[model samples]
Target: MAATASRSASPNTPGQQLFQALRRDTVGGALLLLAAAVALIWANSPASAEYFAIRDIELGYEPWHLRLSIGQWAADGLLAVFFFLVGIELKAEFTRGDLRRLRTAVVPIAAAAGGVLVPALICAAFLLTRPELLRGWAIPTATDIAFAVAVLAIVGSHLPKALRLFLLTLAAVDDLLAITIIAIFYTETIAVLPLAAALGVVIVYGLIASRFRRFFVDRAWAAWVVLLPLGLAAWALMHASGVHATIAGVLLGFTIPAVVGRASNRTTDADLGPSSQGGDGSGIDLAEALEHRIRPLSAGFAVPVFAFFAAGVDIGGSHGLAAAFTHPLTYGIMAALIVGKPVGILASTWLATRFTAGLDPSLRWADLTGVGLLAGIGFTVSLLVAELSFTAGSVEHDVAKVAVLSASLLSAAIAAFILTLRNAHHRRESQE
Candidate 1:
């Protein structure tokens, strides 16, 4: 992933550098999977009690109600870092990347909305008989960008760039939708004072970020030394606001400048790989630089660590693994992800292109089909939502985790098989 991203941002073309950066950061998906696997194994092993104990260990500033378990910290704290990176990607895409063009952006935007809405409705349909289970409707609505892109990088390397870009755009918008859902639906209570303080901090952070964009662009450590503290304050305040702290990451990320200032001069960093070619030194803007630096932190550490904390579901716990499979929520979540996601994305994209003026000439329905399958790989955020939906040690939560893991694995497998065939077809066509 690093090798792919670093190769060259110099090619002054608009989205090339952004795409490369995305590819590079997505490599961390392998590591994230490894962490989840380790957590699962460790939780189910003889050391299961130890694993649970470690995760439940609590420490934090208690007066502010900030004290939380290791697992809670991973969800509330580390995940913010991941969301921060998402914010950066979102801003860049909308302001400067392929999403800057209405025609280019409409298909993915519609597809993402459909992808989210259909899954929620599917889950609702299955759980309609049980009002208690309806809280988890959003569980399958998210697409784990890291896991999906990682699969694409491995299996669809030969596929067209447009397909890849479409996936990225859809996932980014899907995240925004998910964040909105979290803020609106999941938050049980709101503390206006803290929320207002968090917003104030965000505004200040944005202003400082805009004024010193060139400073942070030129010196990477400045972000760590200066921006990190403000980001933390914002996150802490947001947590106190009774809103999910991760939202703070997104707000902070949006504040960072996405494009280079006309007066600034900065070359693409050497870390962008040796293939870094085609830029007028100005193309290596602040957003790209932050992405280059923070992507590793989010993918390599923040996300994987969150996965480690969140994915430690004991299959043999009170509900038992067999019972989990039989649970209605399990079936609903699995159906929503494995079936609903692809169907939603494909149908929405097809309908939009047919009815509207948004279809890209270079894209085909077959390509969109493969992309839709990949969208089904919803692992990380799904698990987070599952956790939010039910109590920590309850049967429903445990069953939901099992469902998320099974569905994500199933989706990845199906996507791999479909994309493998599509890749071969594309290769053959190219040779002709």
Candidate 2:
């Protein structure tokens, strides 16, 4: 599932080619939506039993607790690849991108926090009476970057670049918040020995990645051969430690240095090889290089596969669509996503601007509003949280999935409508 670079690439440089391929956020989002659509259709069809059977079939080494259903493998195993990419992006942002400066980073960081906190409060409010159902309060707190960016690319061609950058930074921080919630709130128990072993493996993995940066950079195969096994070992240990296995990806990502080497005034193009230069002409660090190589896998295959398995809830069950829609949990999730996300983000951004340096001058309140609405399109991490919150095959699980799917679609549609109009206005202003 390696994606070809959509933008022009240096013919000689594979690293740049991979980075260009990763720029195709639209394609990734479409594939993810298509997979979910197929899952829903298949699950509701007459052959639905076959779909569940295939998803339920178990395999793997038993003694290590590795034996899991196909659906479980998609969630616990393959989705780690997605989280690994998230980890790399977070490191890049904090070390080099918008989050590098405290003043520049404050608004998006605060907005991300507001985005998470409000939706969670909304969920908690709805589930106050039904304390048993409160475990799912985190489901609507995530923003699916792929989906939100895809919508922006489609409807915001004329919008300011600042808007998109703001969305990207906000979503990155949103993902960090979601990762923290998962690691702390979702873990029911922890095995101290396995947890400690996993951390030790992560430390060792980081040391090697840092110590031998140039060696791995020179030979792309070296990372696959050396680091892949260590990553898997850490993931396995994390899984055994009763924490979600995906946290291992974040731990490993933090170990990779975001900047490769110090910039020097004397350095020239002639002195650097193709692998050393990024698309923007900065030094290509290990984290960026690895992210480029792995993003295609994460976006094209790993996430879509996870969506296929996770999104296959039978709407034609004995309880039917009405019951699922009317479920108190469903209402909580939908409201949190469709309403709480935008309000929280807008309010937080307003406060940040009022108290701090303020937003980019080119961006208007309308643009921020659209991006805020776009953040409501929470899919991948939302589904993952829903799974973690409820037992599979239980009524609560199915209802939560229904709520997430419906809310995401509604959010994307509403955001698209608003942003498309905004795009037209911007075009008219440009012509004027």
Candidate 3:
């Protein structure tokens, strides 16, 4: 029994750190909300023209052909870094978290599928004849993970803990789908020269990581240093590659050295060497390492920064209530996010579980329904997609932004309502 027992003494340390990082103050969730609120307030002020001008103004400089222009550059380029971090998140979830097992992933994946399909179909039905708007179908399928979680935090204890997790996982899967779609659908044309160069840097970086791992290098930081900048370089190259610049994030994320840490044990050989590459005092737990390395950067810094830029739509502008509400693209987008999202998610998840594959037994439809409504709040990715879905200054783009912001706020309200109601039910059941 003594031999069978093992101890890490602090296995939960990483999870605890991540939990703290994601809270109202730590992840900048509160600040993000404040910034967003202030931005809207300022944008609506008489100095609102200055707000738009600032967002449009180019800042920064680039030497050695490395462009560092701000405004859209900060907006689009830095966001590529944000997406790269998201890719890391998606990879980690599949490798270790709720997505690690088919049984666990089933409910959320199905729900996410339903959420995405319904909104897209809603958009199609509303705008199919105007092929111009068809491209933006993907805009409504995402839920802003940070903002949604922040919303829950503000609403106090009325929401169930289980529902919060369920909503988060569902949104994670939704993010995964959105990443795939961005990679597959939005690519423009192959500009071979820059792409070829980006490929070289990535391959070289991977080889370096593999070599270091094979040789048992303990400094995981080295791997990330190479991986992140190389990813940025890839984004720069891909900008000219006819690919949507964001896809670079996904590609780079897949390649990151998600290699886990080896467990320590007194019995293991002190220096097992390259022949037993996974040996430390124990063996590799690749999932743990990936979570440790990437989660901090993504959840703490990258995601928050990304939100600051993407969520800063000029709502305080000359958008008269009619201009905002009457736009077909606006209303269509609203319905797609608010109405179509939950309904579609419910329907598809139902279909998947009943006829094809079933949801995880741990989850219930009512639980999923609450999550589905939250999934309707598509703030982050919706805004990102709007940038791609429309050219600058077009009516399509303006209306889409207003629609996304409006729908997301409404969805948040609806989800909160449902969650509170569900909590009441849970209390009743427990009492019974």
Q: Which digits, one per residue and each the tens of the lDDT, describe model 3 over residues 1-432?
A: 224322322224665445445534224455555555666666667887876676766554444244533446654565565566556666666764656777666866788887887887788777877877888888887877776776666553544565666677777778768866776677666778877887776676556544555332344565457555766677777766666666676666655455443444332111111221244423443323444455555556565555555555555346554677876788678999989888987886777677656565545677667667777778778887887788755777767877887898888888778767766777676679
- After superposition, the stretches of candidate 2 with alpha carbons farther than 4 Å from their true spots are 1-23, 260-274, 277-284, 317-319
Candidate 2 overall Cα lDDT vs. reference?
Answer: 0.85
TM-score of each model, paired residue for residue: 0.90, 0.90, 0.78
The residue-by-residue lDDT of candidate 2 on 1-432, one tens digit each, is 012221222325775555445558888888899999999999999999999999999999989989999999999999888888878887877888767888888988888988999999998899998999999999999999888999999888899987887898888778778978998999989999999999999999999997777666656788999999999999999999998998898788888877844342221121122344444434547786687667778887899999999999988765689999888999999999999999999999999989985888889998888888889888988999999999999999999999999999999999999999999999999999
List all candidate RMSDs to the true structure. Answer: 5.0, 4.6, 5.8
| Residue runs of model 1 more than 4 Å from their true location after superposition | 1-26, 260-284, 317-319
lDDT value for model 3: 0.65
| Range of the 10 consecutive residues with the lowest summed lDDT in candidate 1 | 270-279
Off by over 4 Å in 3: 1-28, 59-69, 129-131, 152-166, 203-207, 210-224, 257-301, 314-319, 427-432
Pairs of colliding residues, candidate 2:
none
- The TM-score between candidate 1 and the true structure equals 0.90
Residue range 65-182, candidate 1, lDDT tens digits: 8899999999999998888988988898888787887877888999999999999999999899999989999999889989989888888867888888899889878987888899
